[model samples]
Target: MARWKAYFSFKLWLYSFRLKKFLGYWLAVFSVIWTFTEFSGYFFTAVDGSPWKPNVWGVIGLGIVAAIWMSRPLLRRTVLLPDQEVMLEIDINDMYARQDGAWIIPCNRCFLHSHIDEQAIVVQFRNRFFPSPADFDQVLAQVLQNVPYELDTVRGTQVKKYPIGTVVPVQLHGTRQTAYLLATSELTSQGKGDPNLNHLEDSLKSLWSYIAENGNTEPIIIPILGSGRHRLVVSRYVIIGMIVKSFLAGLAQRKFTKRLTIVMQPKAFIHNQYNLDEIESYFSCAGKFEFDSKGL
Candidate 1:
């Protein structure tokens, strides 16, 4: 029964939408199912008995769509965390302060920046290390002087070999959560590639590899990494869906936990079609499994 129900929704999505889009199609879908139900009723009437006698499939089809809509409140309002069975929750909330979970923050190969980014997660994290009223570069120098490493500060940030598709875990002091400096791009050049899907997918794969090897066994909390400072070209919905896919794929390697939590920056638009509500709707139900991408 579930398989057939999924098939109906999948076919509706497969028709015209590529990936990361299903909401608008969903409206049209209700009509399509209505028409299917009517046709089924007519066909059954001719073949067996009165059309009104039983239209079980039609009722089921409409019921499924209604159920999806009704479930939205639970999907959006609840804080669904990743656990042993692989469930994901989407929230346009803070990523830094999540409970004992590790955070996966993206960075350039050189994890340094001139000024704090107003929209990126790094800004929220800056105070944790340098505090306020402190010069970012100078504070970095003073902080780095005590550490035993052969790195230098440049471009408003410290440099490293964290090229695209690499992740460096920066363990925090007096905290259970470690900060993963997920390297998503070489150095975020102006005219060059920012976040092509190939790089993003590979980075996700690398991130999972690190998790698998380290065996940290902590619930993971990650922001939508590329959308803000990284200037990733993908739409929010598309990227979020991509993220769920990669994360789920990673879990298959080893069930990191039962739930995966993603913290989205408060958003109004992502390629104009996606939003946190849709993200909640998609992942909490059939959309996550049905979604796929040609670019990635």
Candidate 2:
């Protein structure tokens, strides 16, 4: 009887286990879906009863939106869904220019790398922190009240200052927006950006968890992770896809209230590395946004 009870208990536990992960994924899925709906939300009238024509104004509006996005250092069009949206813009002109929203910057397991030598967050240090470069660890320790703690699951499994997949929140100099010091990769001896997708996924999972619990509905800005100095060996083609898949799979299952944007550099987009047209098509695909009609 005890054995049977234990087995039953384990099964029951699985139902609610990692509910947060479930939420994140579904919400992300919904974001894509919602954006597609918005893009296709157009209908034209035919008083003569000949045929229902596509709305020219609507098409023009979408074109204008597309033009604005293209003009900016953007790869993907801004996707607004249900109660949230996702954008792909450039941070080249100004990395920390946004007045609001939490800025997420990737760091190593130790969170002790130099911005000059390590470009993962060079933009933040140079433009955001300004004046003198920031001592990130010290900033985390003193300002955010975070201490380096050991977290397993990455390649460089060492006693480190910060936990893997967790963020150390800090405030930028000129702005009141909080800077979420998100650790996306481990300091691989092979170099930076080599942290396996599993680790990156976990870090992203941690990101959603933080937003759900401690974050408001403010906009959040993150870059195309692992595309910088760390240089993860994975093809650039899959980087955005991986991020989208992981993020949508990790958004809160119901009532995801935050706006998320992925910033891409203009040079990268212009170089034809990522097919912007394809990305635009992907967002507008009706099939990709299918979900239950429970009204999230």
Candidate 3:
């Protein structure tokens, strides 16, 4: 009778373990699927109802699944230091302070300039308050002429440039017609400082041109222009969102591929105050890249 009882107890333990493993696998698969679906539904839905409202149960289930999925990987992968390769360089103070590599300097005068050897370039500012599209075009033409690279624009789509170390600008012209201008200004002010919206726009146009011409192969490098000396108040997420939106717009139009690499200088509060883990989390969540000055 005792031997029979032991056999039953062992069978129960084995069954429980197998059940736990099975539950874990499904949880991870569902969480990823739900997250992706939620994002798509939110973007494509035209109605006013909350997308998350319908997925509340799925979200909860995903959370449970994610918890289990994360645990197993914790032991296998060691979080390495943020070491994104340097594809291009921007002439920010900190970036220069850290490395003496080929640098891109914004001419503040020439709408656009590219120094291929140093893998550096600059986008000149056109205005303080707001510049018109004509001004942006003029600046871009100058950039094209001076910057030793090809320009490619298609059917009002974003541009593309080649050679991994390219300097692209994110221009912000206070043109009301331009979607997300106001939002971009608010974001710029929050992130760096007041940036010349026109310069931002011109830069973005130039960026699209570069993408269109060269195709998105090598990662491009850029600094938070208005956010720095320009004093554009904006969050990192907002800036990233704008950039991504532009990239996607180009992609949708079949202008270029979607490969992109964005770089930014750490704020004083962050560099001076936060530890490595907090900073790592911030950039990692924003996008994949190394935080070192080597790849300014």
Q: Among these predicted structures, which one has the highest lDDT?
A: 1
Q: How far does residue 271 in candidate 2 sit from its true spot (Å)?
A: 3.6
Model 2, C-alpha of 164: deviation from truth (Å): 1.9
* Every model's TM-score: 0.58, 0.59, 0.32
Name the best candidate (by TM-score): 2
Tens digits of per-residue lDDT for model 2, 1-296: 32233223433234323445545544555455545655554443357754455555665555545443333322235554443344433232233555556777777766655423633464455444645445544565574344547644434544354666777767665657777777776665434445466667677777867776777667777777776665676755466666655555546343344556666654444333454445545544422554432221
- A best-first ranking of the candidates according to their TM-score comes to 2, 1, 3
User: What TM-score quantifies how close candidate 2 is to the native fold?
Assistant: 0.59
RMSD of every prediction = 12.3, 17.6, 23.0
Score residue 71 of candidate 3 by CA lDDT.
37
Stretches > 4 Å off in candidate 2: 1-76, 83-94, 115-119, 143-148, 151-161, 189-193, 254-258, 286-296
lDDT of 3 by residue, 63-129 (tens): 6666554433110011222332212121112333322221223433322222112222222322332
Q: Which of 1 and 3 is ahead in lDDT?
A: 1
